[model samples]
Target: MALITALGPITIDMYLPTFPDIAQDLQVSSHEIELTVSSYLLGLSVAQLFIGPITDRYGRKKPLLFGLGLYLLATISCALAPSFDMLLVSRTLQAFGAAACIVIPRAVIRDHYSTQEAAHALSLLMLIMGLAPVLAPMAGSFLGPIIGWRGLFAVMLVVAVLLIILCIIKLEESLKPENAVKLSAKTISSNYFGLLRHRNFMAFALSGGLGMAGLFSFIASSPTIFITQFGIAPENFGFFFGLNAGGLILGSQISVRMLRKHPSFSVLKIALLLGLGCCAIGLLLTLTGLMNLSLFVICMFFFSACLGVINPNATALALKEQGGRLGVASALMGCMLFLFGTLTSSLVSSWQTGTTLPLFTSLFVCIGISFICGRFVGRA
Candidate 1:
């Protein structure tokens, strides 16, 4: 599950350090290269809309296999693209196919686990998934010089093929046939709409989604901010990037320990509240030109730590709170979550390219919203 979830972030993070190289080779601006991020996110958010119905109707294994097949094809197209336009098109299709890897794993987890066990399982998954950021950029930076940026896509394709084989060999269909929902558009719509209307679902989803949005903003903006603004070398930027991701792993493990003694809700509240304060200070520092790499990394670590704690717990809370149709519920929560990703990523992509102001501002605002949503959720 962690490996499957890692694909989404690895695809985004691995190629970040190769931006300047890609721009030079493809004869494009940094802004144009970043649009590839937006394009992929758009496809991902849209794909989240329907995977629920399909996955629920069929069991987990078939749709997963089907998606991986398309992912392989799209990734191969990405590697071989001769033009920037072709690369963008291929990335969108690649993300559309990769959506299954991101969304279905949660459904699979929710299918068998509940409460503290579910939270613990998800934390373990996140602990592993968090390592992708720690390693992907370094791998890409190391390999980009040797094989060029296009080779990174080829590498991802190889991983996808290998993951598919592993799935075939080891993963069983988790959603039992008798438990699967009967196929129909109305049932799908009803389940989705019902979940959306539940205040608990909306609350946890928004809180978690906002945290994810903050993370996406950081990822989208980091290449420019770290390399172009801070004068970090392409290859060494992974060290700083890995530092923040390492915080996530630490925070997740800490949350796992905290959960053993505390309720998930309290852990979430403390994490988000701390995140808001940290992000606000980060923004203040950026706006005043007091922000250095050390300060930036520190602030980002706390915020991402909060996110690492929030996501799995919030997801477990939302899934456990909703009683029926785990597939649709999971899908809706994922759709909303990536809805935040799509929006924040686009926001970062559209910002003036060289400034860290957007990164700081986006993080501050998103964290603020997360805390506010949590308060309202408690009241609701």
Candidate 2:
């Protein structure tokens, strides 16, 4: 499950360091290169809507293998992409395939565990997933000079192949025949609408999604802000990036301990509150032109840490009562989550002002809304 979950982050983080090189090689602007991230996220959001009902109707393993196969092909396409447009297309396809890896695992966890247990399980998953953010950029930075961006895609292709083999051999069918939902347009639409109408589910979904918006805003803008504005060397960029990612990992592990004593929603509330504060400080610093590398990085680290708490707990709360509809529920949650990814990434990419203000402003707005939505989860 960890390896499968790692696919999304690895696909994302591993390519970040190569953005400048890719822009140069493909004869595009940096912002144009950033559009690839937005396109990928858009694909991820849309793909889950279709894949969810299929997974619930069929079983986990088959849809997973099919998606992995598609992912393998998409990775190869990405490696061989001849133009920036082609790279965008390939990345969207890659995200389409990776959506299965993300959506199904949550369903599998919900299939076996209660809400609190699922929250605990998700924190463990984040602990594993968090390594990608730490390691992938480091690897990409090291490899970008040696073999270039294409070589990095070749490496992802290899990982995709291995994941395929692992899934075929090790993964079992998580959804039993008895629990399978009937597949149809009507049922799928109805299920999605029902989830849309669900008050508690929407609260947690928006909370988690808005939190992710802040995270993606940071990710989308950080490369340019650090390497271009701050003049950090690409090779050393991973150290600072990894430090923040490590904070996220540490936060997840800490949440596991907290979950042992406190309820998931309570933990989520506190984390959201803290995250909003961090964003407010960051935004204020930016507005006053007092934002330095040290202060900005510190703010991001704490905000990322808060996300580690917010995401899993929000997911647990949202899907706890989903019952046999876990697949679709997970899908909707993922769709909302990555839709926020799409929005923030595109906004940051298009609105680059050669300043950190836009980044921090977006971050502040996202986390502030997330905190508000999170507060209403229990009330709903």
Candidate 3:
């Protein structure tokens, strides 16, 4: 789970500093270059729909290896892409590969652990995984200006090869033969729909999804808000970004300790309330013209910390009810969360006001929805 989740931040953070260069080279608007980011997300989100079921039916190893192989190829394609359209297509394909890495690991964890144990493991996993965004962007900010954006893809290609080798050597089949669901559409639909009909799963999934949307919305707008509006240097963005990532790490670490004492729902509720308060303050600051880059970063840190509490708990709760359908359930939940993220991110990208308004506004709405969902759906 750590490696899988880390891949996304690695891919994203490593290439962000290259955005200006890629834009200038392609003779396009910076927003146009951002489309590549969104395109990758779209591919990742859509591919999870199929990859989940395939992994459930076939066992985790084959699909995971195949996806890594494809990801390697796609990374090379991204490095060699000459035109903007080619890069966009390559990014989308790359996402298909990355999606497998992300979705399968969660299924594996679910397969191996009970609900509380899964949450504890996921919290640990997140503690490690969260470091990627912190370090990756900093690495990119330094390397991007020197090596160019294409070189970042080369790094990803190398990482994919390493992952592939690791998978072949160390990864065992987590899904037992008897537990595997049939791959037919009929079986797939039945499993997926059954999971959907469960109110607890829906509640958990929605709560996590909304929290994720808040983060995604912030990510979509951060570059412009920090760079254009606040006049922060590109080299410095990573440091500030890493601060928020640190908060996430801190929160996840706390979850490990909290799970031993408190109910997961109680933790989730407190986290959501904290998130709502942080976002509200952020919005108030932005709307009232009191927004400073320092203040914004502080608010983001708190907001993301709350998310750290919500995410793993919600996922563990959602996966608790699935006996043989862990993969499909994971896929369904991943798909919905990513779909919401994609929509929220697109909205942030389009509005591009060079201010913190979009960031705070989106966070407020997402948290509000999450809080409401938690109250109604989070009951035992």
Candidate 4:
């Protein structure tokens, strides 16, 4: 699960330091290179619709293996991509493949664990997973100058192969044959619709999705905001990025400790309030022109830290009601996140003004959505 969660962040973070190089080499605008990132997110979002149902029906191990295999192939394609179009295509494919690695793991955990245990397990997984965002950018910043952007993909290819081998050797099929549903059109549609109608599921999904949107917005706009607007050096980007990730790590650690004592809802409400406060402050600073890079980074760290609390609690709450259809439930949650993330990211990319407006607006909207959904949408 840790490996699966880490893969998406690794794919994104490893290439971030290379964005400038990729733009220069491909002779495209930086915005175009950013489009590749959003395109990957779009592919991940769309693919989850299919991958979730397929995994739910067939079982976790097979689809996971197949997805990792495709991921290996896609990473190689990215490494050898000759043009920006090819890179974009390869990135989309890579994200599609990566989606399985992400969605299936949560379903698998839900399959095997109770709600609190699942939250505990996810917290541990996130602790491991957080290392990718913390370290991959730094590694890429150093390695990209040495091996170029292509080499980063080569490294990802190697990681994919290792993950495949690990899955083949150690992973057991967790979904019982009796629990697997037939993948008929009617059954798929009915199952999805059922989940959609579950108020708690939708509420929790929206809570996590909107919380995540803030992070995605930061990532989509950060390069331009930090390097271009604030004139931070490329190497320093990872340093600051890692600080935000560290905040997430710290928050997750706090969550792990809190889960032993408090109910999930209690933690979630508190975290959401903190997240809303942090984002509101960030936006206020931006509006007042008091938002320097340091202040922005500090605000981001607090907001992301709150997400650590928001995500696990919301996921646990959502899946608690999903008795037998954990896979579809997990997929729906993943889909909402990636879909909203892709949309918001594209909007941010399109509105690239070299100012803080796009970032603040997106953050504000995400927190507002999370607050509204959490307050009104869930069951008592």
Evaluated with TM-score, which candidate comes out highest?
Answer: 3
Tell me each candidate's TM-score. 0.91, 0.92, 0.94, 0.93
Candidate 4 ranges with C-alpha deviation above 4 Å: 23-30, 352-355
Q: How many pairs of residues collide in each model? A: 0, 0, 0, 0
Candidate 1's error at 162, in angstroms? 1.5
Which structure is stronger by lDDT: 1 or 3? 3
Question: Candidate 1 residues 1-380, lDDT tens each?
Answer: 78988888888778977889888888999879988987887888788767777888897888888888889999999888888999999999998888888778888888778766677788888887889877887788789899988899999999999999989999998997777887788888888888778888778888888888888888777877888888998767777877778878888898899999988778888888888898889889878889887788888888788778888887887777654477677777777777887788778878874667888788888878888776557422
Models sorted by TM-score, best on top: 3, 4, 2, 1
lDDT string, candidate 3, 1-380, tens digits? 58866887798778987888998987889979988988888898889989999998899999999988888888999999988999999999999999898889999999899888888988888887778987887778778878889988998888888888888888999999998888898998888788778888888889989898888887777768878888989767777767878888988988889999987778888888899999999999988899997898889998888888889988888888888888788888888988999899888878766678887888899999888887566674
Q: Which stretches of candidate 3 lie over 4 Å from their true place?
A: 24-29, 352-355
- Weakest ten-residue segment in model 3 by summed lDDT: 371-380
Answer with 1 or 4, whichever has the higher TM-score: 4
Which residue pairs collide in model 1, if any?
Answer: none
Better of 1 and 2 by TM-score: 2
What lDDT does model 1 reach? Answer: 0.82
* lDDT head-to-head 1 vs 4, winner: 4
Q: Which rank order by lDDT, best down to worst?
A: 2, 3, 4, 1
Cα-based lDDT for every prediction: 0.82, 0.87, 0.86, 0.85
lDDT tens digits, residues 1-380, model 2?
A: 87898999889878887888999999999989978877887899999998899999998889988988899899999999999989999999999999999999998888888888888999988888878878887888788899999999899989989988898888889898998999988899999999999888888888988997787888777878899988899767777777777777878998899999998888999998999899889888888888888997899889889888888888898998787788899999999888887788769878978878888888888888888888965542
